[model samples]
Target chain A: MFSLLQQAASTAAETDTHAAPANAEAAAAAAAGQGADAAHAVEAAGAAAHAGEAAQSAGMPQLDVSTFGNQIFWLLVTLAVLYWVLSKVALPRIGAIISDRQGAITGDLMQAEEFKKKAKDAEAAYGKALADARTEAGKIIAAQKAEIQTELNTAIDKADAEISARAGESEKRIAAIRDSATADARSVAREVTAELVRAFGGKADEAAIDAAVDARLKGAA
Target chain B: MATEADTGLAFHPMEQFVVKPLFGDGPIYWYTPTNATLWMGLTLLAIIALLVFGTRGRAIIPSRVQSIAEMLYGMVHKMVEDVTGKDGLKYFPFVMTLFCFILFANYLGLLPKSFSTTSQIAVTGVLALMVFVGVTVLGFVKNGTHFLGLFWVNSAPLALRPVLAVIELISYFVRPVSHSIRLAGNVMAGHAVIKVFAAFAAIAWIAPLAVLGIVGVYALEVMVCIIQAYVFTILTCVYLKDALHPSH
Candidate 1:
C-alpha cells in the first residue's frame, strides 16, 4: 500500500499498516511493546483497531465517514488559507498588476492621442502661418507698387509744369526782342528819310513817318 | 483471495484511494496532517509562487510566469464577466479562488504517488455547496421573490408550467450533487482507470500494451484535468448568472 511508503522512516518499519489495519496494529503493538510503555502501547493498539474498523466498514475510503471530518477539515483549512492568501496577497497583487498594466496601456494610448492632436494642431498653425505670411507679403508688394506709381506720377506732373513755365518766359522775351528790333529799324528809316528830304529840298514829316512804321508793324511786316 | 491464488494477480485499485496516516500508523484524526495536506500545501505554495512572487515586478511587459498568472486571471475574469455580465464582476475574486483551487488541485494530483485530494467527494461536495449556498443567498438577496421565477418558467403554457417548475426545481437542487460528483468522479475515475491499467502491467505478456494504455490515459487525464476545471468554473458562472437573472 502507498500508506507504508508515506509513513515516517522510523515508524515505517514498526508499523506495517497496509492490508488489515487490525493485524497491522497488532504487529505494531508487538513491535512497540519492546520500546514503549504498556499504557501508551495499549492506547496505540486500540486506536489502530478503531482505525481498522473504520476502514473495514467502508469499502471506498472516500465514502468512509470516519475520514470525512479530516478531509473536510483540511479542505476548509486549505481553502481558508488559500482564500486568505489569495484575497490578501495573490489576488490583489495580481489584480493590481493587471489593472496597473491596463492603466498604463490606457494612459499611453491617451498620451498618444494627445500627441496626435497636438501634431494636428501644429500642422494647422503652420498652414495658417504660411497663409498669413503670404498675405502679408502680398500686401507689402501691393503697397510698395502703389507708392512707386504715385511718386512717378508726381514727378511727371512737376516736370510738365516747369516746361510750360519756361515756354511762357521764352515767349515774353521774344516779344520784347522783336519790339526793340522794330524800334531800331524805325529810327534808322526816319533818320535816312529826313536826310534824303533835307538833301531834296523838302522838310521831313516826323509824325507821318512814325504812323507808317506803327501800321506796318501792326500788320506784321 | 481465490483469484489471487489462481493467477497470482490481485488488483485492488481502490486500495490506492484509501486514506492513511502520514507520520505513523495511528488513527487519522480530523486535524492530522496526511498526504492530502502535503499535496494541498504544495498547491498553495505553487499558487503563491506564481501569483505573488512571480508578479513582484509587475512589469508593464510581464515576465513569463507573470504572463501565465495574468492569463489565468484574464480568463477567469472574462468568464465571470461574460457569463454574469457587469454585476457578476463583484464576485470575481470568489470565482477566481474556486477556479484556481480546483485547477491547481486537479493538476497537482497528477503527480506520481500523490494523493488526489480533489478526488474526495467530501472536498468537492463542500466546494459545490459553498457555491450553491452562496449563489442561492445572493439570488434571494438580489432578486428576492423573483429568484423563484427561475423554477417557475412563465413562458410555458399554463398547464405545463407546473410540470416544468417541478422539473426545474429538481434540477436546481440537483446542481450541487452533480457539480460535486462531476469533479470527484472525473478525477477518481481517471486515476482509478490508470491504476487498473498499471496493474495489467504486472503480467509480462501484456506489459507493453498496458504501459501504453497508462501513458495514453495519463495524457488524456491531463487534458481532462484542465477541461474539468474549466467546466466547473464555467458552470459556476452559469449558475451565478441564473441567480442574478432568474427570470430566464
Candidate 2:
C-alpha cells in the first residue's frame, strides 16, 4: 500500500509538470481533469484526517485525562450560568405567577363561600319571619273566633232571661184565672142547688142545700 | 473520480467527537475555546432563549413559547417534588439546570455537523459527581452519623445485614459511574450509530439505504435525547431522596 501510494504521487507530479505548458486547449482539459483529481485527493485527505481523528477520539474523550480539565472548567462555567438563570430569574418569576394564580383562586372561592353563607342566613331569617307572621295570623283568627263565641253566648243568655220573665207572667195570669173560675163555679153551684130545692113540693132547708152543694163541690175537687 | 476511487475513502465515524480548538489549530490549553466549548455555549444560549425570552411575557394566558417554558418548569418541579417530596424542591434549580443543559445538548447534536456535548463522559461525569458529592455531604449534614444506616439493611437477618451493607456500599459508590455513563453512553451510542450510517452514504449502491437508516436512527435518537435527560435528572432526585431520608 505504501509503495503504490508513492508511485501514484510521483506520477501525479510528472503529469502536473507536463500539463503546465501543453497547448492551451489541451492544458485546459488537463487542468479540468487535474482539478477533478485534486478535488478527489482533497476529499480523500479529509477522509484520512477524519480517520486519524477517529482513532484519537476512539474509546472516549471523556476518559481522556488530558482534556478533563478543559471539559470540567467549561462545564462548571456553563452550569453556573444556567443555575443563575434558573434560580435568580426564570424560576422565581414562574413561581410567583403560579402562586399568584393560586391566591386569586382561593380568594375567589372564599368570597363565594361568604356569599353562600349570607344567602343561607337570609333564607333562614325569611323562614323565621314567615313562621312568625303565620303564628300572628293564627292568633288573630283564634281571638276573633273567641270574641264572636262570647258575644253569641251573651246574646243567648239574654234571650233565656227574657223568655223566663215572659213565662212567669203567663203562669201568674193562669193562676189568677183558675182562682176566679173556681169561685164563680162555687156560686153557680149554690144557686142551682137552691132553685132545685124550691122547685120541689116540700120546702128545702138552706143548711141542707148548702151542705149538699159543698159536698158535691168537694167530691169534684 | 477514477483516481480518487483508487485512493480508497476511509470513513471514520468517531471523528465527529474530536474536541479541537475553534481557532487556528494550537495546543488546547485549559482556557482555550474548543468545539466542545462552542456547542456547550450554544446549548446555554438555547436554554436562555427558552427560559428567559420564551417566558418574558409572564402573561396570565400564555403564548406558545411561554406555555412550553411553563410546561418544562412544571415538569421538573413536579418531578423533584414527587421523587424527593417537598424537601427536594429546594434543589429544583440545580436539577433544572442539569436537565436543560443535557436536554438541549442532546437535541442540538442532531443538527447537521453539530457536536454533542453530553456525549462526552467528562461532562456527564462531572455532573454525576456533583450530585454524588452534594448528596453525600447533605446526608452527613442532615442526618449526622445516622446516614451510614442507609447502607445497613436493618430489616435483613442479623447475620446477613453486614453482607447486605457491603453490597449497598459498593452500589452507593457506583451511583455516579452508572449515572454518568447512562447519559453519555446513550447519547454517544446513538450519535455514533447515526454517524456510521451517514458514513455509508459515500458508497454509490448503498447510499439510499444509508439515508433510510439515518432517518430511522435519527427518529430513535430524538426520543433518546429527551429520555436520557429525564433519566439523569430523575436519578439525581432518587439519590437526593436517599440523602435527605437515609434510614432504610
Task: Mark the 10 consecutive residues where model 2 chain B has the least summed lDDT.
Answer: B1-10
For model 2, residues B119-169, the per-residue Cα lDDT tens digits are 887899899999999999999999999999999998999999999999999
Candidate 2 per-residue lDDT, tens place, A68-186, comes to: 66778988999999999899999898887667777888999999999999999999999999999999999999999999999999999999999999999999999999988987887
* Alpha-carbon runs more than 4 Å astray in model 1: A1-61, A192-203, A207-220, B1-15, B141-146, B196-215
Candidates' DockQ values? Answer: 0.29, 0.22
Tell me the spans in candidate 2 whose CA falls farther than 4 Å from its real position.
A1-66, A155-221, B1-10, B57-64, B157-165, B201-209
B1-248 per-residue lDDT for model 1 (tens digits): 44456766656666666677789777777888877777778888888888888888878889999999999989999999999999999888788888888999899989888888889888899999999999999999999998999998888899999999999999999999999999999999999889888888988999999999999999999999999999999999999999899977
Best by the DockQ measure = 1
Q: Each predicted model: what fraction of the native A–B Cα contacts (within 8 Å) does it retain?
A: 0.64, 0.54
Error of 2 at B159 (Å): 4.6
**Candidate 1, DockQ score (0 to 1):** 0.29
